[model samples]
Structure formats: C-alpha cells, structure tokens
Target: MFAQVRHQLCPDLAIDLGTHQTRVAVGGRGLILDEPSVVAVDSESRRILGGGAAVGRVAKQMIGRTPDGITAAYPIRGSVVHDFDLCEAMLGSFLRKTGRSKLGLKPRVLMTVPGAISPVERRAVTNAAERAGAGDVFLIEQSRAAAVGAGLPISEPIANWICQIGAGTTDIAVLSLGDIVVRRARRVAGEAFDEAIAAYLRREYSLKVGSRTAERIKHEIGSADPLDEELVVEVSGIDTAGAVPRKAVITSEDVREAIAPVLQIMTEELRATVESCDPELAADLADVGLVLSGGGAQLRRLPEYFERQLGVPVRLVDDPARVVIRGTALCVDHFRQWRPYFESAA
Candidate 1:
C-alpha cells in the first residue's frame, strides 16, 4: 500500500546524461527535455547563476563569452560526471524546467552510460542524480539502450547490431537474447572530429579556429566519402601567421580529409566488433545489417560510408539524436519488467 501511494506521488524519469547534451523523458511519456549539458556559475561564489536558469541552452550560448565572474562549462564529460555538485545543480535545474516536482518527494531516475564505464564512474552518476532529487537511480548501458531505441529485436534469438556515435564516445555492439554478444567503445568520436578539423585548418591553412567553428565546418561539409556535388563553407578563424582574424573558404574535400583519420579508426573498431561476433550471430547480421544512432549518425552519406566499408547495409535510425533517451524512457516505463537489464546500482 505504501509503495502504491509513493508511485502515485512521484513519476519515474529516464535521462540520457551525455557529454555534450542531456535528454530527459517522463516514465510513460516521450522525451520532454533536450539541452546542452552546460552550467554557468559565479566565479567567486561558485554558485549557479540565474537562480538555476543559467543552464542547458542558455549556458551553452555563454561558452567562450562569459563575463568576468561567470563561467559556462559542461559538468559531465564522456558520459561521466566530472563535477558532482555542478552536475547535480545542472540536473536539478533541468528537472525543474521540465516540470519535475519541486516537492520533498523524489522520483526514480534511470540514466544511460557507456558500456565500458568503470564501477566508480557509474556510482558517481547515481550519486549526482540522487543529489539532484532522484530516488532509486537506475543505470543502463548505452549500446543496449540504443538497440532498444532503434527498435531492434534484442529479445529475439537473432543478432541486432547497433553503432551509437555520440559527442564523446562511439559504442558498437551486437545483441542477442536481450544481451550484448560483442561490444567495443572508444573515446574518439564527434569531439575528436572537431579537434581534427581545427588541427587541419591550423596546419594546412594557417588558420586557428575555435571548437564551435570547427563543429560548424563539420556539419556543413564533413563527409567520409566524396559526394557527386561537392560542398563548401566560409570559416572564420585567427590567422596563425599574422595574429589577425580572417576567414577561409573550406571545401567538403578539406573537411573529409580532416576527419578521415578518425573515421578510419571508427571503421576499424566497428569491423573488429562485427568480426568478433559468434558464428550464428555473424550469419544473422548478414540479414539484419547495421543500425546507426546518435547525433554523429546524422552526418550526410554516413550510411553509405559504413555500408561500403562494412560490406553490410547500414540504415540510419529515425530521429537519431533522441534514440537513447527514448529507449531510457522505455526502461523507466517498464521498470519492473526491465529490471534485469539495469546494472546493479548497489
């Protein structure tokens, strides 16, 4: 009777606590919050600014342009909590903004993290959520969650392959019987691409660009393979040789060349993951192919690039950015039924 009463008072929440963004959803509802995982704090007081409104999108825009006493930054990196208090504050602020209760009672929260995160890292995530007014923190491996979000039949006997590329890491896995058969994760992902682009411009064009500029270049023209009609974008950066600000015209070929190394690394890792699958599952993959999820999967021609390299048809999932959050919501909606998949939050 007490449990029933508590359930009525608090709704469960599922969150994708990502390196660059945080996505949240109510237990039975779909996604409700999607924001950059950023926070702005007063430098001297070390307190959250704007009465908790200086978070998410607002804080993200303040990056690289904060005032003297304000600092805007991400509290989480690579799906791991770096600053516990700030993470809590950021989560709490987002929860409040998304209409989670401000009352004494706390809600059960389920969150997703990379498959290879350490036990201590997992504990940190739970602790941050608890501090942010969550009860009964639950953890789910990102690859599994992506599989569920991609609508793969993980409970069936056939193998379901998923490649989830996020800002900080890429998780590739094969699932069968609702469990991972083979998996590989690497810290090299979207951020790495951004850095590579920045480095390439500095090296080849003598232009120094900020992180955001590099990212824009990537989104505008970055590609794995050549396109029939090439693309180009104007980029603003500091003139490395002259110490002056300038703009340069960057072509799709330039972006492709810049990111080729990291894309090659991703391809090799994905190939190794697929090769390591069991014989039966390997055969199943021939029919099931591969499903790509996450923000990185939105890159144009990504599916074709993977299909050519992996020798298997690769289909990008719809709404790739919200796949994990949707899957996390499923876990929250059917918590009791999916409890076995939750990592022991001991």
Candidate 2:
C-alpha cells in the first residue's frame, strides 16, 4: 500500500496518440498539450524544427507552408505511430511543454491505444513513451478509455457500446465487466472524410482544395442529414479549368453528398460489429444503446445517422473530442486501483 501510494503520487501523464492529433494531459492538471500529430523537421540539420515555440496551433499553420529544406510529417497514422524517430521527437516536445506539477519527479505514464493494436506496435509505443521521459508506461485501449470518459457504467456487468470517430480512425467496442466484449476498428475517419469532400469538389466544381480547406468546409456546413437552414460556405481553391486560385461556395447538400459513402461505410462497420457480438452481449446492447464520441461525433446528424442505420439509439457525449483525454486522466487518478489490469513497459 505504501509503494502504491508513492507511485500514485508521481506526476503522471495521459497521452491520446491519434493519427491526426496527439493530446497530452497531466493527471491533475487537465489537458496541457493538444495538437496535430505532425512534426516539422529540417532534413539537413537532422533536428526537429518549429516544435519548441510552435506546438499545437502554431505548428499546425506550418503545414503545406514549409520551405524547401523543411518537411512536415505525421508520426502517427490511423491511430498508430508510423515514424518512430519523429514520434519520439514529437513526444519529447509535448512532454517538455506539458511540464510536471512537481519539479524533477518523473511521471508514471498511461498512453492510450486502439484496442486492436498489435503486440509489436504495443511494444514500440511503450518503448517510445519510456524514451520520451515516462518513468513507467502503461497502455489503455482507446475504446475502454473512451467508454470511461463517456460516462458509461463499464464497471458494471450490463452492456455499454461506444463508437469513437477520431481524426484518423473510428473505434467501436461493446463493454461489459470492465472488458471489451466486441471490438472493431476502422481507418475511415476525419482525414478520409476530408479526402472525400475534396474529391467531390474536384469532380463537381473543377476545383483543387487542400485537406485543411476541405476540413473547414466540413465543420462549417458538414452534415449527414438535412439542416434547419441550407447553409453555404465560401471555399478557395485552384480552379481546374483556369489553373488559378478562385473562390466558390459549397452548400450543406454538397457536403452531405460528398460524405455519404464514407458515412454509410462507418455505419455499416458498427452495425456489423454489433451483429457479430455474442448472443448474450448482443441482447444487452439493445437495451443500453450506443454512444458516439470523438471529433467525428461533432459532425451534424451523425448520431441520427447511426441511430437510423442500426435502429439502436446513438447518443453523443459532451465534448466528444476530449473524451479520450478526460478518460485517460480519470485512469491516472485511479491508477493504483487499475494498475494490475494494465501491462507496463517492462
């Protein structure tokens, strides 16, 4: 008990390493670092550039705007780290910025992951956290972390189904007895949504837009169903016909059309996972319904879309984008009690 208390008192950290973004939280301090998973590097100097003074929002602006010598790369993709070196550099910067409340005391770490992440990837993620300054590293599958964050009674034996649509991937899980009963992971998420929107413009409007622009359009007018008002947002892109920059207006209907296929795919994936669940667990889900959380949950009519497709009510938790981080902090706050359930880096 004394050792457990000592370990629990350490200034711990919780990191949600998504392909599109990385969120770092100090157990007691809330979120201190939230930024795109991108890192800008100067190839010749072999040094990470623009991360010290410009993390989160600032570094994000450097995307598609870097000079000849510099390159912006995402260390993570589809909720897994793809570039170990860049990932380490990125994690180091975040840890430095997300300072510990206690000086010189190393923090025990809890890094989040997708439930289906392979053993090889798990070891790599754990190693990276240790190298990046965590005293001890533990992995929490994203769906479980998310379920906790969404306020599901996962500790109870009844079923709780959740779908987390993040920037890089969509994770669906059915929980009971504090363990996942059914799990499904899909890489079709926000980034894919942006690509779909961009492709739609290219074909219909004869315009070329960057991923960022498409994302803006999605947020401003994106929807999976009809809106109270048919809104329009002005978009700037290179006109395919003129090969010059031009401004065009996109409507909610256009946005819906662009996103339909992928939305259908997401819905189908969740439904399929639910269908394949064990008979006893499947019966539980019918009464409990499913909860949708994450950045993609912010999309208009997304819940309704899921509800319609599955015939099971879909509810969105508050501030879905922060659910993973919040749940991570919750885990840290209760680490001593949960430690045995989590495997450490060692």
What TM-score, over all chains together, does every model reach? 0.95, 0.91
List clashing residue pairs in candidate 1.
Answer: none
lDDT for model 2 comes to: 0.83
Residue 39 of model 2 has an lDDT of 72
Q: After superposition, how far is residue 346 of candidate 1 from its true place, in Å?
A: 2.7
Tens digits of per-residue lDDT, candidate 1, 36-112, equal: 99888888887778887789988866655767778776798776898898999999888776575645778888889
Query: Model 2, stretches more than 4 Å misplaced?
Result: 1-9, 43-46, 50-54, 61-70, 100-105, 344-346
Summing lDDT over every window of 10 consecutive residues in candidate 2, give the lowest-scoring window. Answer: 50-59
TM-score of 1: 0.95
Clashes of each: 0, 0
Backbone clash tally (model 1):
0
